[model samples]
Target chain A: MTMAADNRPANAVPRTANRDPYTPQTLLEVAVEVFNERGYDGTSMEHLSRAAGISKSSIYHHVRSKEELLRRAVSHALDGLFAVLDEPAARHGRAVDRLEHVTRRTTLTLIERLPYVTLLLRVRGNTGTERWALERRREFDHRVAELLRQAVSEGDLRADVDVRLATRLLFGMINSIAEWYRPGRGDAASAQEITEAVVTTAFGGLRLRQ
Target chain B: MTMAADNRPANAVPRTANRDPYTPQTLLEVAVEVFNERGYDGTSMEHLSRAAGISKSSIYHHVRSKEELLRRAVSHALDGLFAVLDEPAARHGRAVDRLEHVTRRTTLTLIERLPYVTLLLRVRGNTGTERWALERRREFDHRVAELLRQAVSEGDLRADVDVRLATRLLFGMINSIAEWYRPGRGDAASAQEITEAVVTTAFGGLRLRQ
Candidate 1:
């Protein structure tokens, strides 16, 4: 929830702990939530205004357009995921090891920024901002696909599976987390357990090891 | 494309061949495409009319409301998937074998009914029809989860991963096919190969076999 507040643009966002006294960052948070609840195309600025309990002008004052809020929200998610690729574990290691590291970190990032990442996954390239988001997503997938190819060549990961197909399925399973993972309900697994399950299920497969 | 026509309602639908001719069945086809392209909520009767090259009243004549189209579309998807469970291969086998059979069949079903299933996967439960779709989807998932549980009990599947989580990840990967799978393209893998890849990756770990 505080994710937007943590990375402030200084003058662009007021330093307030409350959801009120809207900052561009905080307002972006509201917009992402609404965009997810009502499909992005269905959501109007009026909906955003109502969700924030503020006037349209108040929303307009913070962000130039709905697309701007969208750009910022998806950027926040993409930045977090791309940052995982830049981490030391992800950057330098045996390719399979690095892929595992990136997978784990990416899952955590999705959880930490659930609403924002949810919106990013649902983007369908209708607007300029959406198209940009899709391109960046493709770039991220390509990087991970390279890691998978390297792992296959190195003989660490299974060579029988197609690298690109494996990449899509692997990330596809990870992204599927957005659809159902709810953090900290009474019966839900802890974040660590969920992360462990993803890593185990992705690399190890579901067949019982002999 | 002929899926909509295969099982027609005796009294409710007209028999037609061309997309422009506007059979109730064919109109449902057009409406499903538009619903998926524009998120269901974002799509209006006007958009459907434009997409179908028919008047709004013409559409209303064929289907009472947009929700009617949605109901039929998702029902087609759900029926396809539920039929997989009733297959002899899926019904009579070792728990793990049945699970794999269902997995392979479900992947093929998703491909066969790709557009309908894609729209089904994206429903968010905003309307009564959407909520009904959500409920049926949950029922379908529950039955699959039961098979996973059985597999684990028989020690054919990994006992360590939670059954529900594994079920989600498995189908999540299968369902993820809707995101990028395009059939019959020049360079794309054949649907047969895609189904094999899903089976291999889901049951066999991505790591090289010893």
Candidate 2:
């Protein structure tokens, strides 16, 4: 799990504020939070300024438009996820091992980049940025589906289920983490613990003696 | 799967137009579709009217407001899910069997009530009705979590994993069906086939020889 933290993209900003003044990264963190709270369509510059305790002009100073903030936020998330595929483990391992590595890392990335990924999931193809995000998301899913197909061909996974459906369910289980996983909430599991449970419960099943 | 079709609620309106005129149920179906395409907050009575090819006054005659349509849509989905718990298989069977029955039925209900469930899943707690829907959704999750705990206590499920986390992942996988599942889409599996895949993939897992 520490490795998961270490692997977070250098550009990935922590959710908490560390300074009295707002930087672009901090502003982005605040904007993404507000975006998640209020849908992208519902949010306005006034909302962002009020939430940031800054002037509307100050917001414009940081970003040209609200869609810019959305683009930056989702790009951050997409970048983090896409980077996982380039890791040594994901690139050069047995098909199942590579798939597991990607799965665990993807879970960690979602946890680390919680707000950004949540925004990415909520996008409704309403804008150019959102449509681009959707297309990139499809490309990512296709890549993982290919891995699943390879694993099945390698005799590592069950042959009974459709490979594509299996991939959707697997990622579905992973993506749903954003809905309920509140970091630092009451008795919440740490990222490492969640990664382990997700892998085990998903691949190992709930049945005893598996 | 035919059993799934037969089990559709008496009040469940077909997605297609069957009558020459509109009823409240038919109006709701149209409203929910537009609400999903354009988010609930983003949609207007004019949009609903335009999609339904009727005057805005006609829409008001069928429903009081947009919020009413949202409340009605989610309540329909919630009702269908809660009814699954009342069935003989869910109430009288062993904990494992009951859990499996609930899981399978939840998937089928989500499919049968696709548009409504999709709207239900996207509610962001921005309105009174959304808040109510969120509360009802939490209550439903709590009920299923209790069942998982019972299954663990009965020695039917793995005890290593946390029950609450397991339940969230379980429903997360199930709830995500709304994201990519389009009924009558290219070579899509039947509802029964999907239910079987969800059960087997979720409980049996993708690992070979498990």
Candidate 3:
């Protein structure tokens, strides 16, 4: 297991062989890993260089600072999540159906972009970048909550439960995946299996029987 | 809001007057507040002293070390949780009913002991006490999983959903209260309201219909 060196600032760019096409992506991946291990505050540029086999200067070439890397990483996760909302299935279906689609897609995205989402979940808003990411996250949550409220209004969901509470319960199930999931483990249960379980658990009493 | 000073090591105790019984509890309360604010790794003994309105040496008389305070705080939360299992509702009811009771009690405990539970959830096993706390958390999860399995066996829960998955889903709903719940923010939504919402949302996906 390669660990980032402790000397330089965490976001430092490593001396790359050359300007590679994947430098940004590669550097971001390394940065996410270091951020997870040492935490955003504890990681240093020297650490990134050792992890990425690049010099600290090379890292700076990719991103301005550790917070910038954090922003980029969370943005990637948010983009993946929001893109699912724009999919044809997510947009045109019944509210419940759309919610199912969103849940499934969110699970898949989280798995595919586990490191990014993990970092996003860990943000505490100590910096402007973190606060911005948090605000964006709230917006995403509110958007989904609107769909849930629509479902309840359409008489497809139970009226007794609060929409905000229900929305949180649903995503809580989804976001907790980051705490325990490891990529490439045991066929790792496909997103379908996960989304199915989540939907079933969520809609069991929530949905009106067809 | 008062913030804990971050000048002391994890093992150093604060010094204080020997006669005050409330001093230890007050100091501990202040310590937990600081732990929640800056996180255990980021906080120092000086932070606790300043937060408690006492000198650094004063804190030492009550607790042996910073980790001891963490151990004590989370232990209180853990005991509150485990005690629910000993309640008549949890011990004597049908599997589904017992599970619901446990869920309700756990949510209430989390709210009533918010800071301790928050600190508990944030622990990353970086030290002996932290690792132990994490193990206890897993044990708590496992015990709940057992009750869930019993519910499934008694035909009180959907068998289609994997028991482990369901357990995680349920606890995810409950544990998530720590992330956003504040002590005095909402009107008409008392602590009871939050706990009931969690129980309703959780058991809605659980509990076999009549």
Per-candidate DockQ vs. reference:
0.74, 0.70, 0.36
Model 2 chain B: lowest-lDDT 10 consecutive positions: B1-10
What ranges in model 2 sit over 4 Å off?
A1-20, B1-20
In candidate 1, how many Å is residue B29 off? 1.5
Identify the superior model by TM-score, candidate 1 or candidate 2.
Answer: 1
For residues B1-210, write the lDDT of model 2, one tens digit per residue.
Answer: 112333333235432323224677767887888888888988988888777766787777788889999999999999999999999999997898999999999999999999999999988888999999999999999989999999999998999889888998898889888888887767788889888889988787788873
Interface RMSD measured for model 2? 0.8
Q: How accurate locally is residue B76 in candidate 1, as Cα lDDT from 0 to 100?
A: 92
Give lDDT: candidate 2, residue A116: 92
Model 3 compared with the native: what TM-score? 0.86
Docking class of 1: medium
Docking class of 3: acceptable
Q: Per-residue lDDT for A1-210 in model 1, tens only? A: 435445434335543334346667667877887898887888899898777777787677788899998999999999999999999999897999999999999999998889999999989889999999999999999999999999999989988788888988888889998988877667777677778888998888899878
Query: What value does DockQ give for candidate 3?
Result: 0.36
Best by TM-score: 1
lDDT measured at residue B17 in model 3 versus the true structure, 0 to 100: 36
